[model samples]
Target: MEQGQAPNGLSSCYRHPGVETGVRCTRCERPICPDCMVGASVGFQCPECVRNGSGTGHGPDAARPRNIAGGAIAGGDRQLVTKVLIGINLLVFLGGLFFSGLVDELVLIGLAFDPELFRVVGVADGEWYRLLTAVFLHQEVWHVGFNMIGLWVLGGPLEAALGRVRYLALYLLSGLAGSALTYAIVAPNQPSLGASGAVFGLMGATFVLFRRLRYDLRPVLGLIVLNVLITVVFREVIAWEAHLGGLVAGAVIAYGMVSGPRGKRPLLQWGACALVLAATVVMVVMRTTALV
Candidate 1:
């Protein structure tokens, strides 16, 4: 029974309530209207199934899916991570300075990852805290300044994407991972300071997230490589191992938290992050126990 062409029993197939269509089923020559149309690269279907046989093309504006490649994270959730993190790191840096008798070297030396300190402590060790503390401690004035600037640049976007809690998690986790890696590879007597580890991790996370989202990677990868090279050549004071560790950790964490078209399940992502943290702790333990 033709729809509108009917009298009472049959409703308007072209504009029926339960008909469900969209435009036309380009294949069957049926009047599909709105609810019954299934969009294909070529044309709409009769909702029944994909028309592998259909040969026509949908017009230029065929309800295309969002590009979603470059949009901000967490759908741009409200956040204040950039401000708060900066403030906290700065405060810690100041405290490290004052507590160490306002001596620049003392502040840098005291709070930084001092493997010797970890080896000799009260009951267990005080060196373990250095890993967590070093991330928040900066040596030179310019050190904190540069770190803050970069932190502001990256934190705004990622915090918005991952929410404040998750963003902080990434920063800390990455820092921890970077420190752990350094301990695992390098001698502990080396006193490493600066938020370079956390910062590198942020870069890593951004790189992975953007690539997964399918944006231009040339910009991100190039920028990260360039900076890392600069750090190696010009900044011997830089803890290369900590930076490397943070980058790897942040990238791994970001992989799990990011969502939408190319994200992992939430539970899976959280679990992965937990595993990374645990692994970092284990590595730190090994470093402490080792003689070198």
Candidate 2:
């Protein structure tokens, strides 16, 4: 017999009796197969031990692991929200391909005439949903590809660190902040669309998260600098306003997520997000007032 294997089938996994395994759960000492292993801070734990939060030598009353934002550490796919967002963006892109009007209807516009609709239509005309819909809108293949890659790269870590709800809030609010700024500053008749705003927001949040964790800042800083340069150099084609808005909003929100008293973390974090949203609303209202 192999080393560490028990005799007479005693080494079989408790959860999978038919499968023989020499590995025992670190928490309960029960034989566990590779499929049943759940990584912990220490050795691998069984599913039951992880589920009950009893693997850390603490009693059953011990709290489950939590992320930086006080969210329960999720098992399995940590980037689920990021994946869903990408899927939605892709679906919208596909829909736009078949229905040409979909892009015009969803793209961000402060005020513009829709020839198809035979009337004036835009955010200023009370199409408030455009503020959000525009976030998922994309016309060019390159645009969507670039934004999706950034989302996959930067979004995964932030979602894992901040948890799903908080990360979703950050992403959406950042995108809205970008749209609001574009609406407020750009010509009312001008149009814009893309997920760059949200992607830039994630970049900003990644910077803050890395700083909080005391990781090497050079990589993130370099990326931010490079992107900012690209925005500046291509300011004529690029919506620098959206990028700027997202970056600032993301950093501010992430700071709120990582800083402040631990006792009041939830209140502080959500309060910061609320403040950003309120500010975006104000920008939209003020711009609409001016346009109309």
Candidate 3:
């Protein structure tokens, strides 16, 4: 042994005693060679820690799945999209309070789902945006507040699972389905505007996403049952038709996204979601044609 070096068995790399590197695993605190070191948030980890999933061997983003080619976390955070959605809904509702004619022009006459509009004005009337705009409208303070709460509760996890683009697609498609159904079933002139349809869609999306991850479905199932009960008990007030439409649309879209093969998951999942949105557009066209 060299004069300055410790004895071979006393304090040397576990994998390479001849080498002088004195690094150790953050988790196990055992001597490790650079070859065995895995980058962790605070310090280096060992292969054993990586294999055991005991350490996030990259950083806080390590736990999130990353795109292999791009190195970006697949879903990132849920804060920005959900907050923006809530902000828009609140701003519109607030504007309606201060401006006497704003609600009539933007929501009731403009955005609320009304089959009669299609019948009287025709699809070329530029009122087609109502399919989505109505999802952001609310009749009362509690209405928007309650719906925003649902969005915050359910949007975070779903967005984290599906990523921003897909999450937004699911929400809009589900809302479209809800409004389409309402237009199909409700009286032609009846005005209906609320985020209940989109909110119900979030619930359905959450249910399907959890099921894909093989999570405990009991809590999700319970929430679904409770909401269904509320819709039934308060059918007159709830627009149960819209809720059912959004729920079915969300579940079907989620199933399509989750059931794809591992290799083609992203491509197939997004394609399936796009098809759902396209189908909703067709429904609107057909319904408007028939009504007109």
Candidate that scores best on lDDT: 2
Pairs in steric clash, model 2: none
Model 1, 1-292: lDDT tens digits are 5654334433334535555432444333455555656663223455443433322235542222211121222333244777878998899777866675322332222223334333332101444666676678776899899889888887776765565667788899998888778767764445566788899989998897666544468988887999789788976677788878888898888877654322335575677589779989898767656643
lDDT of 3 by residue, 184-230 (tens): 66755566788888889889988876665444789999989998998
Model 1 accuracy (lDDT, Cα): 0.64
Best by TM-score: 2
lDDT of 3 at 140: 95
Q: Mind giving the per-residue lDDT tens digits that candidate 2 earns over 205-285?
A: 999877765457899999999999999998998898899889889988999987765568888899889988998999999
Q: What is the lDDT for 97 in model 2? A: 98
Residue 183 local lDDT, model 1:
64
Per-candidate local distance difference test = 0.64, 0.84, 0.68
Ranking by lDDT: 2, 3, 1
